[model samples]
Target: MVEALDLALGGVAVGILAWGFERYRTRFVKSDLIIAGALAVGLLIFVVLPGVYDSIGAALNIDGRFVLLSMLAQFVLLAIILHLLSMVRETNARFSDLVRNISADQAPQMDGGERTIFVVIPAYNEGKTITSVVKSLPDTIRGYTLQPVVVSDGSVDDTAENARYNGTVVVEHLVNQGQGGALKTGFQIALEQEADIVVTMDGDGQHPAEELERLVSPVIDDEADYVMGSRYKGENKTGNGVVRESGIRSFTWLINALTKSEITDCTNGFRAIRASGLEDMKLTEERFSAPELIIEARKNGLRIQEIPITIEERQAGETKKPQLMYAIGLTRAILATWIR
Candidate 1:
């Protein structure tokens, strides 16, 4: 009866492994699947052929049950560690790519002398909305020539093509880095072009192009080194429900308390900064870049101001970020930036 129960449990474990393998095969790399398959096959052999398992245990002078349990624990632990290591490796590779891409070449210069307004739009798979967003941008903002730099963060769709079609200079990542990484790449290019003021807006149509002047006015007028757009203070329209709104308010309170600044909106991405002010700032948050930038800017004693602006609904496609996950990430980013 005991032997039968052990076999039954092993069978259930194998069944679960098989189900997982089938369900997530497409999501995993070929090498990872191969390793998982090999482990499953070995476990199956040890469970089905107890005599072979005993023979191996006897050779090692250990009980077969003990040997089996030890091997199982070791295999599970090794798989977890391997998975974590793979994540680290991938992250490191992406960081290396970001550095390489940023230093590769300077973007094409704008005509009519030195470009004064550099707009950096960071996009993931925003193919559908990118063209419209780029096209709607004014050729000039407040008498300064507008130069749009679109950083495609490893988009698998037609995002890069659409930006190019709209005549914006494009920089692309070979792998998907989060919004923050894309912005860093775009900012570097903007600075390289010797732009007086660098403005950042989402590639999604949520940020109105007509508001571009308002967003950058503080920087251009030399009133503030960094200008952050505030949805609460302006004509704002958000589709986010109660839970998200509450979370935003809580985060805003925490940021204000820590930074000793009264910011109405903490996560708005539509903002502008003087190119010179960014020289000493070190921004490292790839996912929570907006908050990180605010924290870093405040820390460096840069003049920060918030301007009222309108935020419209996204043009197309679902938001890539899950609400719960985004909240957690933003919280983590806020804490990380504060502690750092």
Candidate 2:
């Protein structure tokens, strides 16, 4: 009987392994089939053989009826394992999607600048577009010094390798934390590296590296504590078609109206901040809405300025927006920031 219980527990462990396989093993890997075979073989050898005969059963102190009960136990264990696997896979997939979506966002650049600038790019699963973004940075800016950093947010792809090859300070997250989390990490590194000004950009290649100079100009000129890259002020020429342009126009108008701070594009991730102002704010967000950094700066009486910047369509892959969720989240963020 005890031998049958041991066999039952062994089968249960196999069922748990099957659950993990279903959750993380790639679809091409048929861990489920291997798990089933293992369970069957284990049960047959350890539990079934000993219970087949009274002579051997008594010698082993395992009853035939108890072995049957243990078989039922194995079935229950399998069912529980399957349920757990489904839940784990669903949760992990959702979290992975959130980080991937954030990583695919693009950044803007300054043409030429006279102030020291550090660009922090937060990336996740941006293997296809990072090379172009990194290579596109101008070798020199007239008025600003530049350091481009690519923060790989635990990408399953080769984002980090590409960034390193491009000669950027590549920071990697050990796990998929989120965009806001990645930005904080990048900023801290920039601080330690002693950057006077920091520019935050997305990794999906939506930003023009040349535009960074303009975004940082206000800070270098002492006109603003922070400078935001606004798509509205520049000539209406964008690689984005009419539909995307129209959407951006509507969002810009909404941001200007609600914030009363005259931000032409609050959702745009491309922006430059002075070291002092950025160091003062507590960057708590761990997702895409690091928008809180700007809001908090403004609340603390830090000057905010916007500069005209050109926008471009992604070099490859698709936009990560699932639907109207980004818009809805923006509205909530605006309200939250206003109250704060």
Candidate 3:
């Protein structure tokens, strides 16, 4: 007869399998069905014929009891982990949407004349430079009207105030959401205004306003839907040190290998994207989202191109993240973006 523990675990397996089937009729995938089915079958077999693992264990030169326990622990742990991860991801998505909705309402009314190009600058705690960055943008990018929108990601400083004083559109986050979150807010606001193109520039004064036309030109000319400004292809006058430079190259190579595309700079914050094409990608990273954009842009069938751009050192404020944490966060973003 089967033990109590066997019946208890077997019932759970059966329930999960039933749920998987119900989901399959709707949104469940093949992988989910396979895993659920395997668990149910394995548990049922173990309950009905407990000695079945003995011969398998003998062939493997291990104790059957140990094999049974190991499988039991691993299966339960894996199931719980996967379920928790799904819940967390779903929660994060909902929260991000709500935040964007509340914050993006501050987007100034667009006059809806000529080709509207929104220059989105995501800043955090850069009060000393926010006004300067806003004032530095040209009145037009390749003859199209330019609107500057700044997203202050939970800055305790005067970032939002500075942008507002300069009469620039400011989306203020109530809490810190990292660079990725700020970009998402800015993108949503720009799209709501029926923008023709969205150009993202760093608010730290590192990205020159003169190069804005270079990034936006391809989209304006109908040459490419997505254009990434590559520092490697041009000049990195700031000199990001040897170690950081090596790390950037290493990560770029890995991302290129995974994506089957040669991207010179996967971490550049400067890019130009056609408004319609930008709406198709759903970015979820909270930090270091450059890699995510590259992966998603290629995946979404956008005409991706990289152009040479000059980058300078930050004029004010300190780097928000430490070197070690930056590397770890970037790796996490890459893996999450690539797999998800």
Output the better candidate (1/3) by TM-score.
3
Across 130-238, the per-residue lDDT of candidate 3 in tens digits comes to 8888898888766788889999998899998888754578889888888899999988988888989999999899898988888898999999999999998989988
Highest lDDT, which number?
3
As a whole number from 0 to 100, the lDDT of residue 37 in candidate 2 is: 57
Error of 1 at 304 (Å): 0.9
lDDT (Cα, tens digit) per residue for candidate 2, span 109-155:
33342445778898888999998888888755665567788888888
Model 1's lDDT to the true fold?
0.82
Model 1 Cα displacement at 154 (Å)?
A: 1.1
Give residue 227's error in model 1 in angstroms: 0.6
| Candidate 1 lDDT, 143-223, residue by residue in tens | 888888998888999998888855689878777778888888887877767888889999999899988888888887889
lDDT of each: 0.82, 0.70, 0.85
- The prediction achieving the highest TM-score against the true structure is 3
Q: Please state every model's RMSD to the true fold in angstroms.
A: 9.2, 12.9, 4.9
| Error at 146, model 1, angstroms | 0.7
Backbone clashes in model 1, listed as residue pairs: none
